[model samples]
Target: MALRACGFIIFRRLPPENIEFLLLQTSYGEHHWTPPKGHVDPGEDDLTTALRETQEEAGLGLEQLSVVDGFLQTLRYEVRGRSKDVLYWLAELRDPHTTVTLSPEHTAFRWAGLDQACALVQYSDIQETLREAHHFVLKRNE
Candidate 1:
């Protein structure tokens, strides 16, 4: 069985209709960058895990985010020889100017446009997920 994790693909819209996605750099390991995420706790549902992880890791809670409808992506990969599955759901910050507070697990964070975000994230699956989420938001707003 694969280890499961969940998080939000958080985005904010700035002036001139620029949409930026949030990415955080881990303090440990290879210092990889990714959206806020963590392992699913026993007996907790996926959405609950995503919400909890977002709040714990990014300081953004359910009240600050407007979860997007019909948008979720699951990425399966190997971590330290163990299969891992990460589920990411699209969400928009209720206020674009809201600040993000990071916990000790992450060393830094950035809000970047799709291209920059893709470049910052080392994993190919994450890059693709970001691209897809970007397009999904664009299409939904049209």
Candidate 2:
């Protein structure tokens, strides 16, 4: 069976400048940077899994964000030689200045621009995910 995960590609707007994306540094593994995400629990729907993981990993809830509808990305990869599938939906924080509370699963977090976020994410699949999310927001703003 495939390992299923879900998360939000959360971004914030910074006036007098540009949009910034949120990336978290894991405390484990390669200490890689990724958006808030976690494994799906049994019997949970994908959207519920996304929200729960966001809350557990980043302390953000549905009320704290505005889900940007019609934007979803799926990434397939191998984690430790096992197939993993991760789904990400776009969201905007209700307040651009909201603080992030990281769980033990993450060591640090940053709000970065597209270039920096893509660089920090490292993996090609994740980079594409960020790019897609960026375009989704840009298109919405247009």
Candidate 3:
């Protein structure tokens, strides 16, 4: 059985239509960069997991975010001989001024634009997801 997790591709708009994405650097395991996410608890739905993890990891609640519908991305990968499936939903930070408080699980946090976010992230799938999220936001704003 594959391990399943969920998270939000949270973004904020900068000046002149520029978009910046939120990423957390894990304190453990090579400090891998990813959007706020966590393993789904038994009997919990994916979106709930995403929201819960986002709040826990990023200190951003649903009130701070406007979840973008119809923009879910799933990426599957191998972790220590186990298959891991991660679901990511797109969300826009309603207030770009909202402060981010990191959890102990994360040593650092970044709000990076698409190119820097892609370069900072280690996984290709994550980088691709960030690109897709950028494209989606650009299309939605148009």
**Predicted model with the maximum lDDT:** 1
Q: Write the per-residue lDDT of candidate 1 for residues 64-139, one digit (tens) a residue.
A: 9999999999999998899999999999999999999999999999999999999999789999999999999999
lDDT of 2: 0.93
Cα RMSD for predicted model 2: 0.8
- Give a tens-digit lDDT track for model 2, residues 1-142: 8899999999999897588999999999899999998899999999999999999989999888999989989999888889999999999999998989999999999999999999999999999889989888888888
lDDT of 3 by residue, 1-21 (tens): 999999999999989878999
Q: Which 10 successive residues of model 3 have the least lDDT summed?
A: 133-142
lDDT at 4 for candidate 3? Answer: 99
Q: Clashes in each model (backbone N, CA, C under 3 Å)?
A: 0, 0, 0
Candidate 3 local lDDT, residue 109: 95
So what's the TM-score on candidate 1? 0.98
Q: Could you tell me the lDDT of residue 119 within candidate 3? A: 89
lDDT of 3: 0.94
Model 1 segments beyond 4 Å from truth?
Answer: none
TM-score of each: 0.98, 0.97, 0.98
Question: Which scores greater on lDDT, model 2 or model 3?
Answer: 3
Q: Is candidate 1 or candidate 2 better by lDDT?
A: 1
